[model samples]
Target: MYGPVCFLAPAGVDDPQRPSGGNRYDLELMRELGELGYPVKLTPVTGAWPRPSGADGRELSRLLEALPEGSTALWDGLIACGVPDIVQAASRRLRQVVIVHLPLADETGLDPQVARELDQAERHALHAANATVATSRWTAAQLTEHHGLPGVRVHVAPPGVCLAPSAPGTPSGGRHLLSVASLTPRKGHATLFAALGALPRELPWQLKIAGAQPDAAYAAHLHSLIAEAGLTDRVSILGPLAGAELDAAYAWADLLVHSPEKEPWGMVVQEALACGLPVYASDVGGVPEALGHAYFPGETAFERPGRLLPAGDSAAWAEALNEWMCELRLRDRLRTLAEQRQRTLPTWRSTALEVAMALGGFPSTPWHTELEAAPLATS
Candidate 1:
């Protein structure tokens, strides 16, 4: 059994208006930990994190100073990794355990110098932690190779998917494609639009993008691009959906098209598969792992449930979409594969249990020992 634990993350993790995979994971884990009888206290840090201002730094410092010396603090790497000084100081007092969704430096569209600085800061902060938890094996490897954190005890606890009824698929004479991710550069919305634009205009399909517009300028640009490509009628930008609304969207979708430049673990892919919706995603990061397939492009021997194309390859994405749409047999085969894979997904309870065990250094857990001994996924 673990002692009292403090969960620290960005301020808007619980905000329903801006739902994200990371936010959902943090909220669910905290709830599950509490349900499992762990005394978990959620402490949200409010600020423009990863690039916290002077005031944000002071506030974080105050919060850290007040925490009990022996307290186990599970810090979300978004805030903790970027603030090396603050985390390093807190590590000296608190038992710091960092939960990294993705490395800060890996975020797309960062200036080279800024990325380098973030990499350095994150490396320093992670080195100071008692242990580090990665959301995916790819991220764990990245921490070791890219951040120079070879000594840190890194634990891999992937995000779990909720079992849901299979989607009914496309309506008669209509095909629906769904892309679930935040409207950010990292998600590669522009790349998706470019790929969609290349597809035949007469194709009987509609694209629905469900995500929050965190970047207003980027959102506007997407809207403009849609109009310019004469895709305004074919596309609908549905703001972030949750609970029943999200479930309905998944149920209605024929295919899940994700074009993120990079993902630590694409939670939406698992979610899509759970709903029996075939995924056509960019082959990046831990996406292949989530799809239950290895990244073997151009290898006909590997029977992939869905097509995983090279990231940022608009022409390849267009070609894949064209083939999937025009060939009924291929679509049916992919959907069948998705349905088969859904049964093998891990539950949220298992994820929470793993984290709880990790917090306590995997005490008395044979499963944890086995997981540790298993070969880590390679890039």
Candidate 2:
């Protein structure tokens, strides 16, 4: 019998204004794991994670001590990676597993010294853990290269998508564009704005941005760019929408524009696909994996639901957008491909099962054991 899992997550994971892919993954996994018959003891830790205060460290240490000896402790990387000393101390008695959505050092705009310190801390913490789980194959590879962690110990548990009702796009399909990412430099909002501004004024397209303004300065910069380009009327910055509201936004959009400078895995991409909306995303990190490929039956030739552009290349983005706007044939083909792709998306149950099998090899469940040979879930 599998014992209860001590699941440690960062606080504010449910903040409507700052909903993140990592937070969503954690929440879904918790729910689905419970449904799959695992008792999850959840503890949402409060602090500036990955750089918490001394008191925060004390709180975490106390919490770790409170767990029963030899318990299976599953920690979100944000809560565990920054405190190597505490993690190493706790490792002696607990079977600790760290789930990394993204490496702490990989966040954009960090000072070199700070990045190095975080990297060192993460390396120590992950090394101290019994096993490490990454969200994508790319992220798993990065952990190995960045921290020299053993590939055998690192497992990939990619985020799953709940299929939504297919979007009913306009007849010509280039009227609405959606971007769902926090307003940060890392998300490449500046690049996306620049590309939009370069499009001809006569092109019929409006952009709806649904995300929180996490970085005030960057948010301000994006607003100024929009105004300077005389696009204030055409662009709407809706501060984070969820549930039915987010679903409505996806349904209204004809295309999803995701241009992150660096992404571990784009949950939004899969979400868009699930809704049968094509994507125009930066070809970086695990985005390609999330986007996957749409197979054409009876033909070996495959197509992606949308285009992948060079990261940070505003000119390339502009060119692609212009093509998408002008070519009805291209739009029709991509729309059909998007529908085809939607049928193949992984479900939350599968995601939770993969994670469960990784953390504790449920040998009695023969089907789950098959995932042990192929740890990374193919998109």
| Top-lDDT structure, candidate number | 2
TM-score of each: 0.91, 0.94
Highest TM-score against the true fold, candidate:
2
Could you give candidate 2's per-residue lDDT for residues 37-156 as a string of tens digits? 889988889988899999999999999999888787889999899999998999888888889998999899999999999999999999888778888889988887778766666777
Error of 2 at 357 (Å): 2.0
* lDDT by candidate, in order shown: 0.83, 0.87
Candidate 1 residue-wise lDDT at 335: 80
| Per-residue accuracy of model 1 over 8-88 as CA lDDT, tens digit each | 899989998999989988988898889898899999999888999999999999998898888888888899988989877
Candidate 2 regions with alpha-carbon error over 4 angstroms: 361-379
- Clash total of candidate 1: 0
